[model samples]
Target chain A: MVERHEVRLSGSGGQGMLLAGIILAEAAILADKNAVQSQSYGPEARGGASRSEVVISNTDIDYPKVTQPEIFMALTQEAYNKYHHDLGPNALLVVDESLSLTDDLPEKSRVVRVPIIESATETLKRPIVANIVALGVLVGASSIVEHEFIEKAVLNRVPRGTEELNRRALDLGFQLAAGAVGGNK
Target chain B: MSPTVKLLQGNEACVEGALAAGVKFFAGYPITPSTEIAELLAERLPLVGGRFMQMEDEIASMAAVIGASLTGTKAMTATSGPGFSLKQENLGFAIFTEIPCVVVNVMRGGPSTGLPTSPAQGDVMQARWGTHGDHPVIAVYPASVPEAYELTIKAFNLSEKYRTPVIMLMDEVVGHMREKVELPDVPQIPIEERPRPTVSKENYLPYDNNQGDVPPLANFGDGYHFHVTGLTHDQTGFPTSAPAKAKVLYERLHRKIENNLDDILMWETKDMEDAEIGVLAYGSTARSAARAVSLAREQGIKAGLMRPITIWPFPEKLITQYASQLKSLVVAEMNLGQYVNEVERAAQGQVPIKRVLQANGELIRPDTILQAIMEVK
Candidate 1:
């Protein structure tokens, strides 16, 4: 298992990528690890590209920004084209199945095309929970954080009375990732 | 026993710290990077019977804070670069009147609204001299989210104890980042309140120096009718243009903080006991400096870091002491060069001082700092 992992989640403004980053960081803290989450977005309230980065470490974390991400997940084609080249060596590039991969992908990075948005829309029938679905997929594929802690964090953040909906969305996400990778650790 | 650990954003930690420090009033305008400080306080303050006001503008927010503080309430206002610029006039007013309030400037890139979403340390000089006149200032910068929590409490403490407006300088990175914070219990947190008048209301002198450098400040409504203004005032709290009285008031304002340097100055040193090169940094840049110092040590170059938690009255003595011992020094910050000049003055040409600066809305990376460290002969 990687002792220090940097994860970046990028999409449009309304996609909830920031909340996903927060949940991931909260999960890391719940497991007694150190984590830092930060984000950047344009001036618009929605539709503009947004990115949130989380760094998880067993030891102290210095230089809070993500320099080289070990895990990169992009839900939009614009975000994918902009950031997929900045991954670390032997890193995992997770993107939604909706995005078409370019030939110039990083040489040593592995690409996992999971149906992140589709799982939220078709399987869970709640398009807003796509960020949580993406979180499930990323954690399911990389095992950077435990599923139980992520579940607790997701439950802690979601709106009241929507816990059951988000739980199913997270579970569907895990299933999609497992199907793509043959099994989850 | 286990401590209460929660994953908190830097802004959230600041709110927690303010609430813990007996802050009863918050008046601020919503601005990027620092808006969360106001947002969280707005939601949290009312629940605790504290008042949170979304003022008309940054100036009004500052005025409201000073107004609230005069009533013996611990008040604060948070803003970014543009709003920080707007608050300067009233900030000077608070300083001139010796009102106890905290102004949190979560710094972003700028002379204007340079980068709303990015971090910069451009306000180091502004925090000291942004407001006009030759006056003493106390500004503290924290590098991490946990430190943000701890330092917010310290800001309120210093403000109340000195009866001045204390500036809490936070870069956008520290304001927006999230970290796990092990919060202390209510009983464990130390709180300080402003000293109140012991004499009768008729005999009360708001700016009495005979009592001490920081006299007992009587609240406006607490049976003490004292006058406050931006003009220079004497011990009786009335406007006085006389040179002697003006000189005495000005000197006391500076001396109150300068004389209490032992209590006001807070800093931390790492790997400095036996080092040839010293790096002086603060806020988010200090975190990068720490990594660079460690990397330099691993490369067999003796390097150390002196991070000032309090930046304003300037850590002159500490910087001078380190300058004498080290062969060279490096001043790293997000701005092109603000506090570096202060470091140079304190060093007094004792050693060569190098600078690592960036102002394009990005952090100064550790490797960039390490490269500078490698170049120092």
Candidate 2:
């Protein structure tokens, strides 16, 4: 429970990153921490780059937007390429296996390569649940929010009939991250 | 469904606040950054036995709200920049006719659809004088989601008490940003209704300037026949070309708000007890100013914040009080220089003023304001 923690979820337009950011904020609220979520997207309804930032703090948050993220999740290569440069000290960089970093690293932060999409599509048997899996990895890797709080948030937000599927997807995220290098940062 | 805490966007908060204040009718055409207000109201209004209408255009939407308000229904309309421009004539009509209604402008980058999805505070001046002629206006701006919820209720209450159209001037940042909010119980919050006629129908005058500045408005179907028009009228609501009557009636319209400045003004000040530099801001810019003030204080600089929860009838007297004490003032907004004009007029050359302005649809950052604070003496 640091004084303030900034988390960003970045991916393509249809990746549901905004909802992931929202769930994270709600989880922080469940933990009795103040949280604010802000997002931006391109004009196109799909395939365009989208990013959502969640700032969780013990005190009131004045500047809602994230200037430097302590935890950054890049669900797509373009997202990784755009946001990888700006990292807080010893930041945790979570990227899906489909994207590779061709650029130099900042040396201060740690990187976790997880198969977020592959877990959702092949293992969970539902690609649309990828965002929930990504959320699980975010919690496991950074411990920014609790798993139980996130589970409650997911159940509160997900569609009515797919609660069990999203819950399993979240568990799969934690399992995938448990085996990841430097998972428990 | 009780009054529990929930995560809501600023637009959703506006609807919640309006409903809490007893808003029964919403007439609005969907527009970007503000469509959520209409959407949420459409769903919630019907459930609460209220009516929601998606009007043909912004003009028709404004007219519809006024029409509903005349029938004693608490009504509101939400729009954005171009739509706000379209709403001005009828907004003026509401002002002169002394109809009470809430008009929300979730401002986007503007002039003409400047930026649909981006944030801007370009509507500050437009909210004050968008409609033509000399009339009274009370526009309130909220810096965050909770204030958006609270001030919308206040907007409705003010419109009812003063018998004028109240504007909830919001920006895209506040409108679109999501945050957790704890709403109060509906029964716990106070609600105001438009004052009904105290005298008999024979003695009732819709524009009765003789009794007091704000005459009691009898609802259209409340067994009282009264004429309400956009044109200047006297005791009875009829077109009048008489100079003496026009002068008295027009002055009362202005005097009603101008005379009640203390009752209408709402502002927030922080760390102003012993600060040499003051930051004056409203809307989303105030959030950044709050951060910059704390950051400057950490660096041992004397900086404080003055935020206006109510923007129009611009908090000039309070600004003047701070202007005399502070060495300089910094006005930050998303627009180039909309509200700065009033800040300067209130400062009256008593203190030097600096501006941190942006119109590129990006928010004015905290570090930018902190740098301005460091630059000034």
Q: Chain B alone, TM-score of each model?
A: 0.98, 0.98
Tell me what fraction of the real C-alpha contacts between chains A and B each candidate also makes. Answer: 0.82, 0.71
Each prediction's RMSD over C-alphas, in Å, is 2.1, 1.6
Q: What TM-score do all the candidates reach, one by one? A: 0.96, 0.97
Q: List pairs with backbone clashes in candidate 1.
A: none
Q: Which candidate gets the maximum DockQ versus the true structure? A: 2
lDDT of each: 0.89, 0.89
The digit string of per-residue lDDT tens for model 2 on B1-377 reads: 56678888999999999999999999989998899999999999999989999989999999999999999999999999999999999999999999999999999988896899989999888888889999879999999998899999999999999999999998888998998899877535578777778899988999876667788999898888888887788788988989998998889889999999998999999999998999998888899999999999999999999998888898988787788899889989998888888999888999999999888989899999999999995
CAPRI accuracy category, model 2: medium
Q: Which stretches of candidate 1 lie over 4 Å from their true place?
A: A182-185, B1-3
lDDT of 1 by residue, B282-374 (tens): 999999999899889989999999999999888888887778888889989998888999999888899899999888899999999999999
Task: Score candidate 2 by lDDT.
Answer: 0.89
Give the Å error, residue A90, model 1: 0.3
Off by over 4 Å in 2: A183-185
Q: What does candidate 2's lDDT look like per residue over A1-185, in tens digits?
A: 33889888999888999999999999999988899998984473367667899999988989888988989999998888777677788788888988877546666677788899999999988999999999998898888878889999999999999999999999988887788957422
